[model samples]
Target: MNQESRRALIRKLVASRGECSVEQLAVELGVSGMTVRRDLQALCEDGRLIRTHGGATLGERATFEFAFLDRVNKNQEAKTAIARAAVRLASDARSVMLDGSTTTLAVARQLRGRSGLTVITTSLPAAAQLQHEPGIDVLLPGGYIRSASPDLTGSLAETNLELLRAEIAFLGADAVDDRGNVFTNPPDNSAVLLKMAASAQRVYVVADHTKLGKPALRRFGQLTQWAGLITDEACDPDFVDQLQQLGIGVIVAPFE
Candidate 1:
């Protein structure tokens, strides 16, 4: 496997197992111990792993961030397509709200080049991604960082979201059911997302085809509540039709 893919697998293994020896990883991955050590060193430098004497453990911040990155790398092409389409919808928006999802992080990456835009986000990674852009103003609400994810949560964050207004909000869901319901995986951030949706004049749920018909932990909102849904073209057409039958607008982002 390629270096990136190998490293991703190593991360997943370590995250799940809590720790792994270089010898164990090499045996499991069918690679040399030297190679596993090298990979582990790289992961340590990236703050995703902490190297032990002959093994590695997940870093303090790696639990959520590693999982987040893993999700971001999955179905990346679809997420990129969705981000392109989602950006077009924000062409006239001066202020935007972005939720702390990997898909929405893709949208933030697309917005990096744009200037004179105010971005309010609950995502630490999203804010970090755009913070270096001279043209975009990134704002993060005050809340305790989630232990399981790299985002803000709590009543403080929800109250802060209520005080702000945005022209448009782009959110990501863990699942989008057949009945036009949107769901989040862990349910901790549902209230924060609901507040974001409420504070925006328009909201769009950006997801990929894999999320269609999937079941998640909690229902955040209905597809009808958002202005529309932006998803990759690989989504089933019949499902799209079903959603449209319910008066939900779905935008299929074609692959570039």
Candidate 2:
């Protein structure tokens, strides 16, 4: 395809998917990486999308929705398993923070009946799930709700999270590398996750196996920031080994 057609295709993908890699685009277009990179460069130069190290994603003005409804049907089984494994990491949950993600919503749902636990989350669905749980006190750090996910962020929400120190923070990510870099799709979103983690004593990340090998545009924290990672068998062995080497525990869910 010519430059204009290729660039248009890339724009459509970024608009619909929120993020896309040069590798994915190259494979789909049946073109060389250089060609794809050139197309991306033109788009990036036009300010239509923002380019990362290996990929380009939607820019700030792009109407992207990071909603669970959009992502729910993708990896149901893996998300459930990851969430189950994540819950195991919290031994004593006096206070907790569940950063936004479909998997963390599963964990919040499971915590419904548990007592004396004060649950905090930026995920709107998660807060709603824990609302009626008799023994659980749910707090939604109110701020501007970004509906692509109905998440609370901005300086106000960040301040609220920073005020309370929790026993554990169950975080989620767009990607995690063998080198311990935790990536997020958007820079601002990552900033919130990092802030939430800092308010906790133990940071445990809950990610499905598919999230292991990819790279997102913005990075949230390093692997050393987390005490453990909860994922399933789909995770890369090399990445898991690296985490283990760094004193980061890896808990894989039981295959059912």
Query: How do the residues 36-90 of candidate 2 rate in per-residue lDDT, one tens digit apiece?
Result: 8998888788777899888988885444532345585567788787776666666
Q: State each model's CA lDDT, in order.
A: 0.92, 0.80
Which one wins on lDDT?
1
Cα-based lDDT at residue 33, candidate 2? 93
Total clashing residue pairs per candidate?
A: 0, 1
Candidate 1 accuracy as lDDT: 0.92
Cα miss at 176, model 2 (Å)? 0.6
Q: Candidate 1 regions off by >4 Å?
A: 1-51
How large is the C-alpha RMSD of every model relative to the true structure?
4.3, 11.6
> Model 1 Cα displacement at 175 (Å)?
1.0
| Worst-scoring 10-residue span by lDDT in model 2 | 61-70
Give me the runs in candidate 2 sitting further than 4 Å from their true place.
1-67
113-214: candidate 1 lDDT, tens digit per residue: 998999999999899999999989999988989877788999999999999999999999999999999999884689999999999999999989999987
What is the lDDT, from 0 to 100, of the residue 226 in candidate 2? 72
